[model samples]
Target: MIEFWLCAGLLLLTALAFVLIPVLRGRKLQAEEDRTALNVTLYQERLQDLQAQNAAGALNAEQLAAGRDEAARELLADTEGAQALPPQRTLGIKVPLVFALLMPLLGYGLYQHWGAIDDVERARTFADQPKTIEEMTARLEAAVKSDPKSAESWYFLGRTYMAQERAADAAQAFERAIEVAGRAPELLGQWAQALYFAGGKQWTPQLQALTDEALKADPAEVTSLGLLGIAAYESGQFKQAIGHWQQLVAVLPAEDPSRQAIQGGIDRAREQLGEPVEEAAVSAGPGLTVQVALADDLQAKVQPGDAVFIFARAVSGPPMPLAVKRLTVADLPAEVRLSDSDAMMPQLKISGFEQVQLVARISRSGNATAGEWVGSSLPLASKTTEPQQLLIDSADSKAP
Candidate 1:
């Protein structure tokens, strides 16, 4: 900030020079004009004295003429450069001097009204990585203070508050972000999570509304799903917890590091439900192979680029898929296998379900739950090894 102000001062000085240099030059020219007038007055007086001397018989005509010529020569010498000087316009001099005096003030006023000085200061503050959480929090606090409308700053500040375990403060920060950036699903989820933690893990109607709003906008919002799972687990709603965590697991990428932790949560929830935990190390167990194909009548209804989801769900258990695979319509008639390795949740494997149903759905919108066409297989043993045929021949009546 000091450096910024120093640079601004230098520029201000440069601008003043442009306005003031002309005013100074104008003063010098005015002084030269005054001197030229003085020299002319002296020359006229000398000429008058010479003429009087000649008329009074003190000198002859030739001598008087010689005196006048000497006066004329002296006047010419004094005013030699006066004619070359551009005519001094008093009209412009005062106005420029006034403008020079006011330029700095005007510039400062305009900058105060419209300049991004605070942003510059904030940028300088953030140039270096903060060494501590407290330092980072302080910087973010200052940033939001300087730029209250900056949604990004508010978001970071909220995250930093959460890191510092100031849940209530984090909730406020997230709320500010939502206000400034509109109620984005991610921000809504964060706000709900913060409020949940701030209230001592107590679920409230407000929190429910916030989470519902977020999930409604984006069903796969990870933060909201995770938060709901945590709240359900704490409230002795193990089934609900499992449902939420399973959704989260399904949306997370296969390589995401957080998937392990979420799976751990799901396992814990399952334990609370007294579900038998398989003691043996789960490996690639017997998987069901299914060949999926689009129906001939529906060929014109779906694009080749549409997503097709193939999965196995328990016949009478939770609705979440045990294993799933995704492909495009162009890959119709493709053979895919569903095994424990493709499980959405670590504890929810196809091998755990005695009877499962195979499902194939073609969704132009890429949503697994909702699609334009779907096909299903009758209740079959999870250990079925032979390849089964599936056809997307029916309209997706379950799709909303």
Candidate 2:
């Protein structure tokens, strides 16, 4: 700010010079013009005295003429040689002075109106290096208060809060950051991490949602992979933790400080499982508990041996099921659990989607893709905790 004022003052001074220099020169020229006028008046008086002497017979004609000529020569010498000056320019000091004063005032006014003063203040707020994590967190909190619209400020504040283990505050800050900066993968991961910690690392459906959404946006998002691994490890799913951490390690830079810690975590997971987990370990997401029953009217329509296929598919993604479970009409009114352990493929699981649709179909033709009777639940979170009840009453005449 001091430098800013210094530069502004210099510019204002330059403008004043432009306005005042000409006014000062005009004053000098006016003085010379006054002297020239005085010389002309004196010359006229001397001529008049010479004519009076000639008329009064005080001097001969020659003397009178010589006296008049001498006056003229003196006038020329005084006016041209001593008092000569450039032509006078019309100048009003009042206007120039007014403009000179207004120059600085106007500059200051415009700066106050449009300058990036808030940005400067934000810089200052962050410039004072903090000696400890607490100090850094306080500074970042101040910065965000000063500039609430700055997404960058909020992000750093959230990270600092995380370092302090203030998970709820960190979650709020990260949510604000995402609101301002858009749902970029990195921001989403931070939001998920904060929420995950805030909930005591219980790995709620919402946390799973945030992480899944982040990974969907960016497959190699390191933060999402790390959080997923941590959640799996917490839930005693060491094989699944190994799979997620392996993916995280593959994308991390060789020199990254977290790389060693992540590798250590992976090693621990392997030891827990007593083996090097392969892709097979990837099938470790929580199962969905559901009660499926035949509608009273459709009880006769479904045969006892008719294959009942229960599956989960992303609400807005590929047609393939993330996980599936097979049953029969005889299993109607039975409780079943569909899980990643029942994944249709090694690479796909319920954990891959933020929201999922539950589907149950009676494929009498033995074609799982095209069935005779099907029922579907509206999209629910993939990690929904409470058991869902579904009725198999709808026709599945439409093509898949």
Candidate 3:
């Protein structure tokens, strides 16, 4: 706020100076006009004197002609000089006063309304925050509107929405970006990620096509390889999955969290295929349940393809958010119950909190459409109760 005031004050003062400078150095119109008139009168008087001498027969014809020519020349020179000076404008006090007042106001108004300064500041702040998948989607929408041509913004939007489990929106956004960007590697990777996640239980040849295209462009892209490995792993293509994972491991840092995650996944794939498990010191936590309930039925207004954000926070800690989950409407249950047994639940540590705050939200377009949050007193060590269920039907006294 202080910074805002300082900037505004500086602008106002600058405008004030602009107005005062012109007023202070203003030309003296009255004095210049008087001087011009006096010169013209003096030249006319000299010409009259010459004419009188000629009329009195005290001057020859040549002398009279020369005197007349000289007088004419002097008169012409004075006229031209007067014309060379700019004419002065006599403004009422209101003109400068209005200008002085309006200049800063107009400038500040424009700056506040359409300037990039504030948007950039907002963007920086948003980036600094721990963005939930839903929040990232909204921010991506804002960023795209603010700068439509930014490829990075568009790509990030597609990726983020995909992460939030909004496949259709992700596909559409990716398609739009692809129209503008053509076949860039990063864009292909983003699009492939969306497709891979969206296909879910029915991932098939279509998923492979996007993955192939993405890998063709950038063979070493860790995300592309990771998705390919997962897809192959899911389809019981153990060799193929191992091949992809091994490539990813080679390219990724050994200490990368993602590497550890992929390794764990690869280990599972190997075990499923009757291969030996690689024993890595992974901190495995106890499993728990995550229940998403709506206060009322939201299916009529929300689609299965829409994005839903799920988050859990510990009851007794800094709001440093414990776990976040995102899924498409398709992944959501009418009142979904997630147990620790689910593989994707690994990314979210449900066992970490004894008492936690759980929130479920769905965004229509880019705004929140349906949401329910529960502050549960249940401990992780305690037996999971009828997994916290959220009913979608609203219990409002008035119609929505």
User: Best by TM-score, which number?
Assistant: 1
lDDT of 2 at 92: 71
Clashing pairs in 3: 293-390, 294-390, 294-391, 296-391, 296-392, 296-393, 296-394, 297-392, 297-393
Worst 10 residues of 2 by lDDT: 276-285
RMSD of 2: 18.7
Count clashing pairs, candidate 3: 9
Clashing pairs in 2: none
lDDT by residue for model 1 over 1-400, one digit each (tens)? Answer: 7777899899988998998887787788788878988998999899889888898999998999899889889998888867556654465677877887888899889999999898888878988755444667788899999889999999988876774458999999999999999999999999999999999999999999999999999999999999999999999999999899989989987745456557767778878889964342122246888999888999898898999999999886767677788899998879887777676545567888899999999888877777989999999998787899999999999677
Writing each residue's lDDT as its tens digit, candidate 2 over 1-400 gives: 7887788788778888888999998887787888989988998888888888888999889998899889888888887755456564474789888888888888888988998888887787767545444566677788788779999889888876664458899999999999999999999998999999998898888888888899999999988999999999999999899889999988876544356457768878987978763443222236687888888999877789998888788786666666666788987888777766455443456777789999888888655667888888998998897999888898997535
* Native-to-model Cα distance after best TM-score fit, residue 354 in candidate 1, in Å: 44
Error of 1 at 162 (Å): 2.0
What local lDDT does model 2 show for residue 204?
Answer: 83
